[model samples]
Target chain A: MEKGILETLVGVLARPTSTIRSICQQRPIGWAIIVYLVASLVSTIVWIETGFYDLEGMGLPDVGMPTIIVGSIIFNIVILVVFTALSHLAASLLGGKGGYGGLFSSFGFASLPGIFVAPLAVVGMLPMVGALLSGLGNFGVLIWSLALYILAVRENYLVSTGRAILILLLPTVVLLVLSGLLVGLLLLSV
Target chain B: MSRSKIIALIIGVVIVVSLIVLFFGQEIVPPHPRVAIITLTGPIQGSDGGLPFPDTAITPELVRGLLEQAEGDRSIKAVVLRIDSPGGMIAASQEIGDMIKEFEKPIVVSMGDQVTSGGYYISAHADMIIAQAGTITGSIGVIFTHLNVDGLLEKLGIEMETVTGGEHKDMFVTPLTPERRYLIQRITDAAHDQFIHTVAEGRDLPISEVRELATGELFIGRQALELGLVDRLGGRQVAINVAAELAGIQEWVVIELAPPVPSLFDLFLGGGSILREMAIARLLGDEITLLRTLLKTYSLPRY
Candidate 1:
């Protein structure tokens, strides 16, 4: 039983290395490009409708809400191009076999889980109860991140989990730092 | 770029644009919690998903809701009940006060222009009760008011056409006769006893010590702080800064939950009443701070 467990563990770790290499062989950096493009687009659109685009002269350009609406489209397309370019390049380099249909659908897949958060946010509409629910709900992103990484490096789910978690930390941490800096600036201004 | 490449780019752009519309429809503007807020809006007993009212008078259930919110959230490490109420039902104040004590969090009280009677009773237990310089806090005791038209009608007026399980069931809205005054005082005294007990427990003093301060005096924010009624005289920013300092977190996320629904009645009030909206802002804003302040207080309840 112990020997079998050891084999399973080895397979889990080694599986991702092969899967990643194979995907890379098919096309280089395909997953990273898609993730960046989709995330940026989604974030932009969410912010704009939230009247975040109205936060002009507060630091960012005080873009008109309608203009922001239009910009969301443009920005999303920008992300789609850059992200797709990166992914296609990775796939081509790595010899992974996938079509544009799969690639595009894969982008859609990344966003599907985000809607689950709406229900939690709905509960969060309560006072403290709602806030707690929303916090837990937001953690769903971690789940989605894991899925995305595993989808890219499909061989060993365990290894994919680790890699996805580690790689995605880059963007999340950067966002945190950026928020921290913004907070500091606001504090200084105050 | 080739024609196919251009076409692919256009298609990608179109998809991004469409997705953007869906995304914008749900805009993700970040929340800014300006101050310490505890929401007490809505009927103390809520209805279904219909529009909730903020103007509904304060109730004990509302106080209970505030306490529970203050107790559970980590962001609310410290609290200042920004009360602008005339007071609420008798049982509500007492039970909410009880819940307030069970809270291990530091609570300060800030009375707006009108914290009186039962409002003052509830405020009595806070660590410090701060009232605006002109803020009125304390009717110093309890008294129930009712229009006694029974005798007025008996004199050529009609009586409140009614029946009751007990003689006192129609106590309120009945004539305040001498006998009725005694009865009302007796009822008020019982509730008053509970109120004073809360004061004593909250102040960490003997009932006698609380009684000493019960000369039915009301003080403003600065004076309240001096008299141990409130800790300081300040607004939302001060409360939030205090909580932040206490929590020892410089870079933590501060989240404030928005109200679930809007009031349709608010439409009749002419949507933009600055003063009323400011009050609403205070209530909703404080809950977020309570969440920060009560971090350890709400670590985990067994049940």
Candidate 2:
């Protein structure tokens, strides 16, 4: 039986491997999009509350709050799409047979950990231990989310844990190498 | 509901509550009496986003926004304008000065390393001016430069033609005729007089006394204190104390009205300019860096 959205969300955290396998089989793209949207909106709200877009105090040009909110959400959505696409390509290159829809759905659900950023940001606003705790909490959330993503990739693609990690790292490594080469060429020309 | 559903509901509630609290917490809580510190650094210009660098100069719009924030906040009982500038455009300085003069609450100015010309124009209207002993200030004059590049152009064998609807339309590029010279002199003198009068009015000194001190001469903080240009010889802390004292608050929190914490976007945008500036600073030392900045910011008809 197909799981409910709430059950699947919880399962992604509670039993990521099994839950992600179910998600891949189910391909709940609409629910996945909704989850990603909520995560992005929460992240943007936390950022605003933490005073991220207040440029006036720094003597910089004031970028409108609305602009930041909309821009950041759109930017995050684009990143998710691109990341999922790149990871799908990487999985394909590694002889995985996962459909793009399944990977995208699982990847979107992986963003559920980002909602914790709101609470962590509040903890960060504390007087003394705020920053440290917030930083550690955010780091923890990132790690947890990465683990979920790895599980999602592995289950969807029928890959080993090591191969899943490699698939995830492939996009970043390629991007960095390309950037470095471009910089090197520019420097040489200069 | 199942156990997972209950857990999810709890998590959902926690996130909703956090968002609501973060958004509305400040309004819900009673704020403490605070003294807001608004910094006026670098040359005071009309607006930000000047070439080479954008954030180096102080702008009237920035000052107005900060002042308005302090004015609107009931918790903020007083404001301290921490000014560190060599001064820039005349109109920008005057606009900021008018804001200071019109502010309902007590305002104090704390002078930094260099507060001269247009800087002093804005500070002159503050309820009190505090400066360190070594602070360089009091360049109380207006300057309008007419660059007659006709000579340079002639030397370069590049003759230029000009069409004028008015007699003084081409006065800037051409050599200043006696009539044009007199008109320009009158304008500068009027601006200088206005500066003297503002200083006298704000400091409660006689016009003659202020005039004597407003000879376009730079004075150290001690000399300014003696000359009645500055009220006291102290630093930012003293200014803050004075502001709090003036506001009749024995115990108060000092809130710096600063920019919001920069986001990743801001860092990405500002990183190039910051790195370029650092490189320049390293290559040419601090003084040259400052000179370069001043050159970039410099405009005509300034105090």
Candidate 3:
């Protein structure tokens, strides 16, 4: 039997390998969307409370709080879709046999780590040790989320851990090489 | 449940509890006695539905809201009104000026780059006014501009026909007659007298002395100090110190009262209006924009 949403969420952190495999087999797109929505809502709330979206201090027109909240939620959802598509494409090029729905579901579940942002933001509000603790906590959460993402790719694509990491890094490597070549050509022309 | 699952569940519960606390933990604690700073920048006008721009225009409603906030808060001992404007509507300025005079707490005005005409009209009523050495101020007069575009319309081969209930109803659209000019001049003179009286009363100067300086001539902060138009020659820090001194507070914090956050509906509607204005301005070219501004400016009596 397929596990429920709550069980699957806890399972992702507790037993990632099996949970991710179950997620691939189930392909619960609706639940995946709900997960992304919750993560985005949490992110928006933290940003608003912490005044992270206020641009007036930088001498720019303030895109008001409502705009920031709505814009961030939409942007985050778009990023999830775009990131999944790119990762799936890269995995396909690397002789992987994962389907799109399985990869998307796993990637969506990976966003569970972002829920810790709320607690970390509260720590960030402390007077002296707040900044350091918040920074380290956020870094840890980011690494945790990245690990989940790698595992998602590995389990869904039926690939080794090394191949999954390589697939994820493929886009970045190509962009860097393209940028380097462009700079060299500009210098030669000059 | 397994050990790892139990740990994850505990962590999840802790996160939810923290989120609830963060959202609902706002309890107003009595703060240290502080001097609240309310900044008034840009042209003074009526409220524009509370749009969040970089440099928000000064409005009587905005000032009143901030003043009410300061008055209600027991911790706020005094207020520093930091003003940066080239003046605006006469009625709006008078409304703010009246509020300043009636405020129970000590209030100080800190002049910025150019606080002239209606700007000075409002600042004159503060308990004390401080300005930088080169701050432009003291344009204590009223002005009314009448634009006659009939000749321009004729040149463009466009004649305007008007139906009016009164003779002067169409006076603005046509060339000003001698009688209309005298009538307009009298109104301006009355407003000018009112400006002079306000400055004299607030500055504790004689009517004749204030009248002599009310020639619509601008004065720098040093000249204003020498002429008794301003009490002190200094910056915002000096104004804050004077406010603190007047309030008789030794140890006090400084609080800046920012505008209220805009709602979602306000964001969508106000943002649409701003975009519409920008689009019109871009499509109409610079000259049309300037003409529209001039028409808006001259449509009413101003200080």
Clash number for every model? 52, 4, 0
Candidate 2 docks at the CAPRI level of acceptable
In order, the candidates keep a fraction of the true contacts of: 0.04, 0.49, 0.20
lDDT of 3 by residue, A113-161 (tens): 8888999987765545666899999999899988998998999999999
Give the range of the ten consecutive residues with the poorest summed lDDT in model 3 chain B: B264-273
How far out, in Å, is residue B53 in model 1? Answer: 3.7
Q: Model 3, range B62-158, lDDT digits (tens) per residue?
A: 7887898789767689999999999888889999999999999999999999999999999998999999999999888888878876565565566
Q: Write the per-residue lDDT of candidate 1 for residues A10-116, one digit (tens) a residue.
A: 22233434433343333323443443445555555544543334342122445566676567657766655555445544444444454543444344334434433
- lDDT for each residue of candidate 1 in B196-258, tens digit (9 for 90 to 100): 676666656588866666655665556655555555566655655555555443533343432
- CA RMSD of all predictions: 19.4, 5.8, 7.9
| Separate DockQ for every predicted complex | 0.03, 0.34, 0.17
Q: What is the C-alpha lDDT of each candidate?
A: 0.49, 0.83, 0.81
lDDT of 2 by residue, B1-303 (tens): 998899899999989988887787667754567899988788887765433344467877778778988998777999999999998888889999999999999999999999999999999989999999999999999888765445545655667788999877865556778998898898889989999998899889999989998889999999999988899999989999999999999888787886333443434334434444465678877765654555444425789
**Candidate 2 total steric clashes:** 4
Q: How close is candidate 1 to the true structure, as a TM-score?
A: 0.43
Model 1: how far residue A79 lies from native, Å: 27
